[model samples]
Target: MAIRNCLVTGAGSGIGAAVAELLSGQGHRVALAGRREEPLRELSARLPGPSLVLPTDVTRPEDIESMFAACEESWGPVEVLVHSAGAGDSARLESTTDTMWDRQLELNLTAPFRCVRRAVPAMRKAGFGRIVVVASVASKVGAPYVSAYTAAKHGVLGLVRSAAAELADTGVTVNAVCPGYVDTPMTDRSVASIAAHTGRDADGIRAKLAAAQPIGRLILPGEVAAVIGLLVQEEALNGQSLMVDGGSVQS
Candidate 1:
């Protein structure tokens, strides 16, 4: 395998951290971008190959620009882009405030769009690039609450599909990995939030989330990372949303 220059957002923990480990272990040069410098620095220390720890908030356009500029300066153009920076919030549509809606769209939808726009021209010029979005089962289907999050995810999926088609002939493939309830810190937060609101035991809420997956357990971060590794290596799999939910939502 070629040692590509890869950039991954949300690299402090969860899916992004897993992807960083997998790609770096394979000897790729990785640029880790996240809001926290300490975690990214720690992850960079443990990576097997070359890496840059960039403290960035993807929601800010200036921060995104600086991230890419730094990557270009350190390495060359990014050969692989893994956008795993996202968050989930649960609230009924009626109760969801404008701030909540905007935050969801900014982080989950618009941020990736900006990153893709910034990365694609260089990718098209290189004539070989991979863009993978770590989406969620919420990207494909709906739930009772989490309306804002679901909407943002669904919109991002649409973005992935449209961009994949547009860049299909440029040797740049765009795809998504939509996993169900993954065992990550994000899910932990979700469980805590639900417990606080409903006055239920956190463990029970977590158990319920696990059972929602067809496999009767939460998906592992490494499992999702493996799928991302596949997407990054394969050039034929464009405009595809590979579901990693253990047979849930077989689309």
Candidate 2:
């Protein structure tokens, strides 16, 4: 694989961290972008190859622009962009406030769009690019009490498909990775929330969620990162949603 500059949003933890670490290990110049500076710095220190930490809130367009600018100044044009900067919500439709809906859309759907729009120009100039959007299994299947998150993820898939079509033959590929119940800080929080809501022990709630998957366990961050890595390969893979859900979504 040709050495390239890669930008990973939400690279501070979870799937984003794994993807950034993996890409750095594979000899790619990785730019880690996230709202938190501490983890980004830590990851930069730990990862191999050249790495840059651009602390950014993906919801802000200026921040996204600055992140790309920093990457270009430090490395070169961004050859790969992995958008994993998103938030999860669990509120029923009747209980979902307008603020919650807006927040979910801003973080999950609009933010990735802004990041990609900023990066696409440089990618077009280079005539080669790989964009991977981190969606969720909820995008395809209905999960109770998380309508806002599911809607945002569905929008993300739509964005990927539309952008992929527009960038086809332009050497730019756009795709989405839908992960289910990964063992991350986010998942930990979700488990705690479930425990509180159902008055069950944390272990019991976790076990129930894990058993919900056909694999009988929660997915791992590295497992999802591996799928992102595959999408970034030189092969022409675009407008596809690869689910890393432990067989939760068989479609």
Per residue, candidate 2 scores C-alpha lDDT tens digits across 82-179 of 99988787876898999999999999999999888888998888789999999999878988999999999999999999999999989999999999
Could you say which candidate leads in lDDT? 1
| 158-201 per-residue lDDT for model 1 (tens digits) | 99999999999999999999999999999999999999889999
Best by TM-score: 1
Model 2 steric clash pairs? none
- Badly placed stretches (over 4 Å) of model 2 are none
Model 1 alpha-carbon drift over 4 Å, by segment: none
User: Residue 105 error for model 2, in Å?
Assistant: 0.1
